[model samples]
Target: ALHLEMTGFLVVKPEGYVEEAAAGEEGTVYAEADYKTQVATNVQTQEVIDSVVVYITGRNYQDFPEVVALVEDATDQLTFAEDAKAKAEAAAGTGDWQNATLWAGQWWQYQVKAADIGLRAKTFLDEHGAVETAQ
Candidate 1:
């Protein structure tokens, strides 16, 4: 697994995960988390024949609520897709590999979505606000 940390952000991903970046404003940072792993396999082959992958990206610039709102919207969509996948698996029932894979694959995509990268950015800014306020 890979781990990353900054003043107010943290990310962890298993080995082999990929990261992509695009040009943006000076202070803006972007990171994409790949959550693709073996989701199902062929019973007879006993080999990992099927896998799924999707990218969840988080972007931020300093500590702005507008930026947070954009990230939140993307995260919301990612969560919706994840929940639908779970429900599909449950409804597919056991020993039904074909149906399970089919239903789950319906929600899996190689697309990138917005995600939350920091849970403590606001706190960090609050703690450091003294410098700004004092100036």
Candidate 2:
């Protein structure tokens, strides 16, 4: 079965960045980090298939409130089902398997969200679900 795991908002700093931020070290710079908000997996096989994530760059180490707001804003922007569908379809149409898989995973997320609200949703994987094959 398709398993959707809601990871929610997670802010991951670079290696040692957390300690540096805690120590209030000077000359600290900011870079972007991808936060996984949600993930999809095959329950029977325990294989990760897709995920919803967001990236944000920041400068201030103590500005968690602002960062929280930014995360919320970015997460809100990803809830468009139509946009996800369009992107997924467009990618698939162009035979961009990589992007197609990414967007399709995103589209599946919207579908799962829809299902949670009592709306009908479709599955993204085939009848066998997601299977890992050696490349």
Candidate 3:
């Protein structure tokens, strides 16, 4: 006979938006939510653990091309943020307070893009992914 037991779980919810401007026009066009899960197992004990994460994102676009560009830019920004965070951590460890603080500020500034990131992601998922607003 075999038995399975539940152990532990966690969840994360994130929300954000993207805005675009072109020719003095600006708008928000898309929004989205993402869900993720993680699991762990103990073979002998037959115990399982699971975790979930959810993120919400949105964006505004002046045109379809702008939306596409925004998506690409947002992806690049995310990569930059990751690198900046790592550099900041390294600076802190090295006792370079000034550089550490600057990097840390950069890391935090990158966090502001969460909304823009979400918006671009959502726009990419949509079939007619662009929305325009009168300015």
Computed on alpha carbons, the lDDT of every model, listed in order, comes to 0.39, 0.39, 0.44
Per-candidate clashes, comma-separated: 0, 0, 11
Residue 117's lDDT within candidate 1 is 29
* lDDT of each residue in 10-73, candidate 1, tens digit only: 6666699887887776642212111122243212112211111111112222356643564465
The global Cα lDDT (0 to 1) of model 2 is 0.39
Residue 89, model 2, lDDT: 61
> Model 3 misses residue 72 by how many Å?
1.2
* lDDT against true structure, model 1: 0.39
Highest lDDT among the candidates is held by which one? Answer: 3
lDDT string, candidate 3, 33-112, tens digits: 10000001111111210110011122244345655565566556656767776786686677665555566556545544
| Residue-by-residue lDDT tens digits, candidate 2, 4-101 | 22354555556777453356455522211111112122121112212222012212212345434534543454466558657756865776655655
lDDT score, candidate 2, position 135 = 29
Model 1 clashes, total count: 0
- Pitting candidate 2 against candidate 3, the one with the higher TM-score is 3
Better of 1 and 3 by TM-score: 3
* Model 3 misplaced stretches (Cα beyond 4 Å): 1-66, 120-135
Worst 10 residues of 2 by lDDT: 30-39
